[model samples]
Target: MSKTVVFIQGSPRENGNTRALAALVMETLAQSGVASAEIDATRLQCSHPGCIACGRCQEGPEFRCHVDDGLARAVATLPDYDAVVLSTPVFWLGPTAQAKMCVDRMASLVKCSDAGALATPLRGKILGLFATGATERDENLDILERQYRVMAEYLGMPFVSALFPFCGVPAGQAAADPEFATVARDFGVRLAGMLGGRKCCDP
Candidate 1:
């Protein structure tokens, strides 16, 4: 069966290294007949008014958010996809502002376990991550990996493998490392297989 894969591009530079890697992944996924959609958060304005103590969404199965913007539209589409991929350039050794805003705005779907809310819509879905950085360093990659893991856990999505490519000294030069592009392609194929096996099509 076919599956939906949503890719969130978090780079402000449209053709930066991070975006190039994300494009490679999308191309690979196309070979598997998976439905793919992409959103460039950097080009869109996403306002994140820190989460309030409100519990409206937890009151029912409805998917709703307080803020209205591109981020809300993107959040509304999450449950419809079998897999989600977040691509971002390393900012201060972690996720960029665009990526962080999108993830933070998803608070509407998360309710405390003891709150007796319905299951999160993201549960059981496959989640993947791709990141690009200026230099290849174990420490910085660790930071990026942990940030994605936290996002997956909070959203109730399965934390899958993360593909990180350290572009050479120059920040936006991932193509310089051809091997990294191959890795991105492989990541895409594997994620597609996981989504197909999970049968995570939304209602």
Candidate 2:
């Protein structure tokens, strides 16, 4: 079966740098005969109220959130995909508010078993973080990467990579950088290869 990857774009601006990079990645994945889905978090009517510590998901064999919203839908669909790519623009040294909201809502994925041990539906999944920013400094990038790394660890997922193409401001600026496109495309190819059951050597 062909692998399916979901690309979630967290930038509120249409045609922003993050979206452009995500598009490039998706295009490359398509060329490799991999299925892809793009989810624009800003476009969704996601009023995620965060996790209320409700024990509903642990109440039955079927794990689910009581909230009826787009976030609930996202949590349900995320586990079905083989890999997930999160693309966002740096805002205040972290993911944009829209992206953070989605991430916060993901707490619902943590289901409690009858033994009361915590578990997440995201186990064994592959996750990649892609971001763009106006600064080329590592300070902001470090913050973003740390956050993503922690999130991946918490969900029991392997962080495939974190790609940051910097100096993107005023939107669409990164489009002029051919190097950024090359990097994004290469990252996509590698992710596609991994999805195809290829082992990646660490360098």
Top candidate, metric TM-score:
2
lDDT (0 to 1) per candidate: 0.72, 0.75
**What pairs collide in candidate 1?**
none
**lDDT for each residue of candidate 2 in 61-139, tens digit (9 for 90 to 100):** 6556767787777766878898888888888888887777667667667776568777876888888888877777486
Among these predictions, the greatest lDDT belongs to 2
The residue pairs that clash in candidate 2, if any, are: none
Per candidate, the number of residue pairs that clash is: 0, 0
RMSD after CA superposition, every candidate: 4.6, 3.8
Give residue 193's lDDT in candidate 2 (0 to 100).
Answer: 83
Report the poorest 10 consecutive residues by lDDT, candidate 1: 194-203
Regions of model 1 farther than 4 Å from truth = 47-61, 113-118, 169-173, 197-203
Candidate no. 2 TM-score: 0.86
lDDT of 1 by residue, 39-85 (tens): 77776555653345466656665666766667777777877888877
